[model samples]
Target chain A: MPNNIATVLSRQDTWRGRSQRLPRRTITTGHNNLDLLLQGGWPISVLTELMPQQSGIGELSLLLPTIKYYADNNQLCVWLDPPYQPYAPRLAAADIALDKLLVVRSKNHAEWLWAAEQSIRSGALLLAWTKQPPPRYADLRKLQLAAADNGNAAFLFSAPSAMSAPSPAALRLELQSLEINQLLLNVRKQRGVAGGAQLQLSLGEANTQRTNLALLPADRHRTYPVRQFNN
Target chain B: MLKRDIWLYLHFPLLPLEALLPQLPTEQAQKPIAIINLQKNIQRVLCCNTQAAAWGIEPDLSISTALALCPELELLSRQIEQEQQLLQQLALVAYSFSPVVILTDSGSLNHSSVPSNHSSGLWLEISGCYKLFKGYDALLRELDYRLRSQSITAVNGIGQNPLAAKLLCGPDFETQLPDQTEIQRRLLNADLSLLEINRKQQQSFKQLGLNTVGDLLALPRSALSRRFNAELMLTIAQLNNEKPFNAPRFQPANSFRDLIQNPQGIFNKESLLFPMKTLLQHLCQYLMARQCHCREIEWHFEPLIGESQKMQIQLSGSQNNWSTLLMLSRLQLERLELPRSIEQIILYADQFIEAPMGVFNLDLFDNQKTAQQSCELIDSLNARLGIDALSQPILNQDYLPEQASTLATPGKHSNTSLNKKLKAPQPLWLLTDPAPVHLRNKKLYWRQPLTIISGPERLCGNWWQAEQQRDYYLACDSNGARYWLFRETSSQRWFVHGLFS
Candidate 1:
């Protein structure tokens, strides 16, 4: 009987490790390089923070492909208080199912949190995004639990000023611009992976490189070495 | 074999008082409340609460007398319009039990403005329904419970026909007329005053020493026929089921339209809830009777002056439940501001569909239930927040990144627009307005100078409208961020359109 109990306990551990089990499903970010870097894609049922150095950076584009994936699968993607008006033509150009993308707006942070939490807990939505002031630890914890319970991927976008504030997200990445055609992704936090991995990605056209380089600020032009990930 | 038809009668003798009782506040409800109306230039009690009746302040007593009898008597003006509406509401409830419901108020058929002393009643044919409910006792108990739940006090009776049911319905008459033999026995023992006759004729009948129905029936039929009118003869024949009586069957309306006059203009939002509740209850009963559900409702509030303002509530799907409907309405009403407090409130609905099948007949996994709950939550949010405030993004067929996608109200998106496929990869995010950037020496910069390592994909269109020509590229800023930039071919001005995630 004691041996049988031990086997049962071992079975529970196996369930968590999922080594012999089928792999859990994930939503891909649609960029091959980014997907390769993150080990398949964004994991399901957890909160991911997208920390942008400033507004109007291509931070939203990083998630649009993943959002479109869910939308095509008949799941909803909700946006809470996007800083800029999400221009429609560009969204359509990204191949997102417009009908599946929901935009929610509220007057204050409390309302924003309430809407986000409800949307996550509903389970009817596959993805939710919120841009607000740095939420309290308890609020983020509540959102994390709700997202987990509903098996949804929640993304909280914070301003660069909030970099010092503590967060309860499972993953946090700092987004910065390398050039008009390049981006740097700094993985500040990840659940299982080691932090401080920086990835440089090349986007857009490759042939028309006639850019006026003299217009850039010489003092701010510094390069960081990109870290290699072993898969 | 078909069973003989049985009709049940429900009579609310004090309907005017009962209709207003459920909405009365707790403290005032404990006091004696009376509905007073003017009769022959004298104010008299049309109906009195049970508390008032305990103090000998019954209907027909002068208002002054009732006030004198019970010093704490709360007198309310009798609203004949409200009384008529209550009668229709009762008919609707009766229709729920049996299809054949007949409003037995003879005076109301003509839309009389005067409040009648005669107890208003409904006739429900229930022979087909008794077995479904197991038995008449169970049926009667269920019916009584439902009526009481609605805060209505009723005297119920069962008979073979409408006249017999009505005769058995009063406080002084028998409640159940079981069979032909028992019905005849009860009818014989019944007082002659229960017959539909004028006061003078009743007095004459008493003078002739005919107090009971049996007394009049004992006389020669030909002699009675010669003495009474043809209507009286027909009444006797109907009592025996010897003549076919034709009364209009009450059918529930396909649409609901009710106008409530607020004599003293209501100012507070909370005060509107009472009238709103009453209207919605009536609407629900109407739906129940018709076996239908409504997805939309319109409220037309006519202020004291100017044209009426209309507010509409649209649900994602049809709903027959009243509490949920009332809750959604309350949320919306809280956010609404009434400009003028003047005149009348009208609630109407025409969008309806057959009610969905029973829960047992739905999907085994309760998919329908979950969908309904989610729909209700969405509806509530839409009500609290404006409907325009909630939207889903849909793809537009424009080549310009700014015009490619549009936000649509959920459930109203066009299928054609949603089915359009994309031809190429586009940036995930586009700024509402593209900001101008500077290009100096083969590099792009917006805040900080950026490097371009990609080719220019040229796009030009909108000749019919605002013409535009641009060369778009993907560039990285100094901090290692990717951006979608464009240069206007006409002016060589650079702008950032989107960011690469």
Candidate 2:
């Protein structure tokens, strides 16, 4: 072989032997207000549990801004199993484009994992949602590897009353409805930070006015609508 | 001839006769034990050497004749199919060395251009393998080492043609390459036998002085063709590498496998996160063809040679995604002890909630995107929080839009909407189970003194209750915010429930 071609081949081999590494970035929920309230936007490297209000509260509304942020940023926000139709009209009313949301409907248990794996491996997807239980160690490791390999985010959506399973997430959360217009969001457990302090909030009115009248007195309400910022 | 045009044919006996010798009965390792294949009960001649002389068996001899010569001879069933598979495996392994590796039919090899280990059992056509592999010698050593590691043994031969290499590299060659002149001279000499055609032809050839390979070749080409049949010319062409040998074609089965380096990422860690999205994409494609969606996915991971540990989750509404299930699993998986290194991940999306019921083909221009947007919005919140956290209120049976403003699960249209009281557009705010504030002298200071601008628009119901004869009023506060208040004459208590501005 000619020296030049040999040299080129050698260089190519050397280059390929060590793949070009992509930079790992930290995930930040786009809503500046909510992001400030969360621990670097819901623990970038862990799973944060979501507790819905059994008595109808602001669960959906609270996460809208964040979901919208991801969708706008070219990140895929997947909702594996959702109770209500993310009525595109309602979501559009909230100003979210349906195209940015990848709605997946899983048929069985096996497929849930398969889909999770697929989403995790896509590298370009910003988020994947599933209603399945937490992953086992191997898949969790795969997820962590994926997190390290690709700078994407993944999330699991399950019921509040669901039984506990293993966790590979950095944080855990439990939410409850405090009053008609007040929601109680609590961090049950967090990996890196110790987070348990109720931060209060009221459902911001549609007209953008303060509706302190709707918020029950903190002392009066048994379950206070709170944000566990310390976590 | 161009050097590049020199095609070297190579073949290797996967189950070398030497390797099988000791496994056989007695010290037959030294016996001339050749492994022959039988097709339709007819034993076809295969490979043999001086070792079989002890048993008095030779190549081309039928099994019955060999058995008669040696009473203790062992007979084995031929496994051509198994041998073919094994050889194909060997070929695949060999292909890794060079893309140019081709199966040779003559059971021999030619690699005269490169010097390689005689015991390596690998024949390298350096010209082609050199480019793919770093060097011709490197390729030979690699193939040799790989084959040895696989525990397959063979005799290596390198030459320029099938006949030359096979005839030279046998046990008879003393493990040395044959000289080109000696090989060519022998081949030429053998050609003289071609004159021994049919009985009458043989007699004529003998009379004409043709007896050996060299003598047969000495005849002019045109004269030989006219005098003998086409087989005579074909034999010579094969000897001179002029004939082509088609190789056996084969295909392999398809299999899907994944190597999960860290399965704990989905379990032990909370704050549902996926480090890899590529895996998700692959998984999506795999499941897409099955026409299914994952509702509840669980992960069961097994380390190499270890027991499987799986985490299961229940979802209020099942979703098909990596993050949702992972997140659910993350919280539940915090305390699990992971194996040293996970070999595989088994994911179970057990909760199979069928696809949501919605319009697949809505008027494309209907532009009812708001509903979908709300649905998506509700889904996300439900993901991080529980399902009950979100709701849009429905009025009670009071025929009141104000009551309808009470928070209810977002989409369900319960009997609350059926109430005749909620016929008109209502004020945004509505209080449930109205609270009472004593009105001093029928003048109440509720949310700024309603200037008493609007009169009591009275329509009384529930009068049957022995409680009170209630009077209703649409009172306007000085601030233009109208209030809907009711009075209980018996208790003389006034309550504010909604507004009209």
Best by DockQ: 1
TM-score of each: 0.77, 0.42
Clashes of 1: 54
Alpha-carbon shift of residue A107 in model 2 (angstroms): 9.8
State the lDDT of candidate 2 residue by residue for B131-223, as single tens digits.
Answer: 665755566667667767655665554545543344334332122334557656655555333232458767767788887656766778789
Considering every candidate listed, which one attains the maximal lDDT? 1
DockQ of 1: 0.30
Tens-digit lDDT track of model 1 for B1-501: 646678777888778887666545668889989988788888888888778889998878897788788998999887666777778877888888888888865422324534545557778888888668888667777788888787787887666767777776656323333676776677778888988776877887888899887888788779888878877777887776678667788887767887667656867778777888878888988987887889899988788878777778989768877788888888888777775684678899999988877732546654555456456656766787778768766566666766665667877876544344533345556676888887668666688887775758877768554348888887766565657788888788889887654
TM-score of chain B of 2: 0.36
lDDT of 1 by residue, A1-231 (tens): 225655544321125554543233345555555655665566556788888786555677666656665655555566777755565545655556666667777777776776788777654443344444467889888887776655667888887766788888878889877655466889898776788988876554342222232332222112211111111
| Model 1: fraction of native contacts | 0.57
Model 1 misses residue B121 by how many Å? 1.9
Worst 10-residue lDDT window for candidate 2 chain B reads: B113-122
